[model samples]
Target: MLINDNQEQIAIATYGLTKIYERNIAVNEVDLQIKQGEVYGLIGPNGAGKTTLIRMLATAEEPTKGEIYLNGDRLLQDDTNPHLKQYLGYLPDDFPLYDDLNVIDYLDYFARLYKLSKPLRKQRLQEVLETVNLENKRNSPIATLSRGMKQRLSLARTIIHQPIILLLDEPVSGLDPIARLEFRQAIKLLQQAGMTILISSHVLSDLAELCTSIGIMELGCLVENSSLDNLYQKFSKQQILISTLGEYDKLEQQLKNCPLIEHWEKLSQKNHYLAHFTGNLEDASELLKQLIKADIPLHNFHCEKENLETIFLNLGHQQTS
Candidate 1:
């Protein structure tokens, strides 16, 4: 279900957007809506049509049917609606960069292409370099940078025009742990700056950390779309971990009495137990109260919500070849 927050303005909306190649439907009547300043994560398997949808949104590939709107303005592939392009910045999985040009020069070239004035170009170049943490490599050749640095540079180029909406397709495809961390930090900084971002990546952990909302696509169709909180409330199972200083058997007996607890198992650690809780916060609180009343010598009791991967798998939308 699409979130309808009347107070928030829609940054991007697509009505029955679709793309077809031969008899194969690349995107099947997708009606996507993203609010301004939202970090929307798109997730699916390799052949899920995420790239096709994003390419259509970027105006890089024209959709065979449907209409795209940017801030209430219809986005046209033709030259008549050229101004709509300014509000968008798209970064594909593989982007071409000028290997011979230094970082600053390459950014300047794109800035000029976007028709930014000389003064604005200079200001934006510096700002984007700083945003991506590439200030030190401003004069370094693109070919000399590491894979992570190159990705960051590509991102800087995408945002050099300071677009209100950013589209990223697998922005962290190949990078070491440290590099991915750095790239994630850059994305957080961008989110803090209030740019509506839509990112499609196989990294569910990253998406869990960054996305305000998530959409799951399968076989060219969007099967799930919801705000992260709602999705969690609806699908994520709540688990409670308890550590007691008292005997494990006594704790187990007390847990068995509680109807809210579906089941529980002893942890590898002594006197630690993990319980599958089937209730809301208040029920969990009542369980804690009952445990205390039973004098189980509870030392640690905390809830652990199911992570994104667990939720995704539980929803039965596993990737297919």
Candidate 2:
């Protein structure tokens, strides 16, 4: 379904994207664009190709240099579109099923291998076993479930063929914080059924609380690709923290008469203060309206939004220093 049913985009564009094996370079050249229903996150570490650029955007390899645009069509994953496998639904960080197929006959054997018809494959296998709740483990025994019910029966076979773009490798890797909160409420019920995910996880706070745009592969190269508030408003550096209702030596002598606070210190006692933002937010908002017109007792203030594991350890310590 080459997206454009009034543009419900599910993007994954790339260019200059490279990959190599025997001779090294796992990923490089990478440029990116990921939008659609946007849950995009692909952080790095562990040989940082982020699983070979998500196995070449789930086309399952083939791209020593590249192009990938899911909803904007231009397909491949051995393209021969049988509705492009109902719009991709890969789940590969080892999501192989059929241990004597049980959970509703393994989602009615992939909804009749996506051929669907037998009463719409029993209505999309009872609607993906109630969107992965696994309705009473629908006749259990995929080898006695539980590794979080076999990761919610592999997300009910990656949404029994209703795939509107999903590629979730490491989908809750070996759960058990109550099955990773029931597989994060079955991926927030597949993003409220609008689906368009592209997750990868080494759990960075569960992809910083279930992604809202991210793309940070390292060695393979597309370092950061936006929106976690535009990647901390374009690579962070807006840290403000002032906690004084009274003397931190008169708020560090009224913040050393506010010189657009390029840097300040005293992180404890005398009250507490910290500042750094020479990126000059209009001289740090005219030094916070001249400390509220010199009343000074600003009891508390905090502004620390540069977290995604602190922008993934400051971009892996600025690419290994």
lDDT of candidates 1 onward, in order: 0.91, 0.76
Per-residue alpha-carbon lDDT of model 1 for 162-197, expressed as tens digits?
A: 898999999999788888899999999999999999
Top candidate when judged by lDDT against the true structure:
1
Instruction: Give residue 235's error in model 2 in angstroms.
Output: 17
After best superposition, candidate 2 residue 191: deviation in angstroms? 12
> How many backbone clashes can be found in candidate 2?
3
Clashing pairs in 1: none
Off by over 4 Å in 1: 1-5, 242-258, 263-273, 281-300, 317-321
Give the per-residue lDDT digits (tens) of candidate 2, residues 1-321.
Answer: 234445645466677878888799988888777767778878888887877777777778888767777766665656575555577788887867777878898788777877778987888888878877888889877988878888778877877878878888778876767888778788878887778788888787877787888888777777678777778677767778777677456567667766666668876575677887554556666766677677777877666655687778887898899
| Candidate 1 Cα deviation (angstroms), residue 15 | 0.8
